[model samples]
Target: MARLNVKPTRMELANLKDRLKLSTRGHKLLKDKQDELMRQFIILIKENNALREEVERELTDSMKEFVIAKSLINELFIEELFVGSETNVELDIHEKNIMSVIVPQMDFNIKEADVTSDIQYGYLNSSSELDEAIERIESILPKLLKLSEIEKTCQLMADEIEKTRRRVNALEYRMIPQLQETIRYIQMKLEENERSSIVRMMKVKDMGTNN
Candidate 1:
């Protein structure tokens, strides 16, 4: 760390000391905040990994079911069945604060009961595989929404951690050291001035005694 460019004086020393004290305290607090943010970030990462794996597995299963259904049913009929279905989903978004970082929160609401209910198509013509696939996909919606929220939260937290880490490094490596060095220089100058003044006084006193 480079020493600060400052006047070597008692007043400058006092000011620098005060600044050093404040900088040290701020650095400690920032360090603590960074640690906590890392902890939360790690936990979110783990959750994201696990949720991603589970979602992938369920998606594979659903896709397999869909493929089987497609093979067994008429392609035109399947397309018509999907085109006739009406389903609506609403999402509510908000924010929650964690360790000074705001992260997203989401809530999903399905507009109609039929969204998850049995398919309206005639059973005589439609295969059960299609119904099973649709149901499986519908069941995974909530988890998918939750996964989205978690992933976004993790991103926000990671950004905050990086920001905090930078601040802590600035204080520890630059500002605090500069202030300390400046204060030491000022104290040394004051001590030297005091010693010089004492020596002059003693010489004057000895000359007066001889006269």
Candidate 2:
């Protein structure tokens, strides 16, 4: 925090008083904004916690299904197999801004991956279970992506909230107090100066009357 310049004179006292009032008003407004942001941030944190638990549970279930499918495929006769052609899965990426912070957007063409080339290796006619597993994994992908989005947004909001909180505290606890103290100092000096002027005027008047 930078120190405030408080070189005030009687001529500039009115201006300082007005500025003090404005600063106090601005401090109140910023404090209100900070409080609101904190409230929202707390809510977001709780939501993020719930989403994390859900993703963990879903991933556990998915891994179990994956292992079962793999074991079944390995047990099947080798002569009854058909091999499928592989294709590269391309992902499109974009950026979205949330409160001036940029976040990533990912697009996976799962529909394109659905079309598989015929293969010969197993007695089974098709990889229906494997396809189902792939689809399940694909379904979970969007949820995971959504979770990432939520987490990042919450992080950005938290950062802003903390910054706002610091400014509010500085204004409320430090800046305003120092400004008030300076105002008091200037007021006291002006009062003393006024009393001295009155005393001098009375002394000069008495001297004139005597002469």
Best by lDDT: 1
Root-mean-square deviation of every model = 2.4, 4.4
**TM-score, predicted candidate 2 vs. hidden true structure:** 0.76
Question: What lDDT is reached at residue 95 by model 2?
Answer: 81
Per-residue alpha-carbon lDDT of model 1 for 1-211, expressed as tens digits?
A: 5678888888888888889989999999999999999988999999999999999999999999999887887788777777667657798998899988988889899654364544456766587888899889888888888999999999889889989999999898888888887787788889999999999999999999999
Shift of residue 91 alpha carbon in model 1, Å: 1.3
Please give the lDDT score for candidate 2. 0.70
How many angstroms is residue 53 displaced in model 2 relative to the true structure, after the best TM-score fit?
Answer: 1.0
Please provide TM-scores, in order, for all candidate models, with all chains considered together.
0.92, 0.76
> What's model 1's lDDT at 154?
93
Model 1, poorest ten-residue lDDT window? 111-120
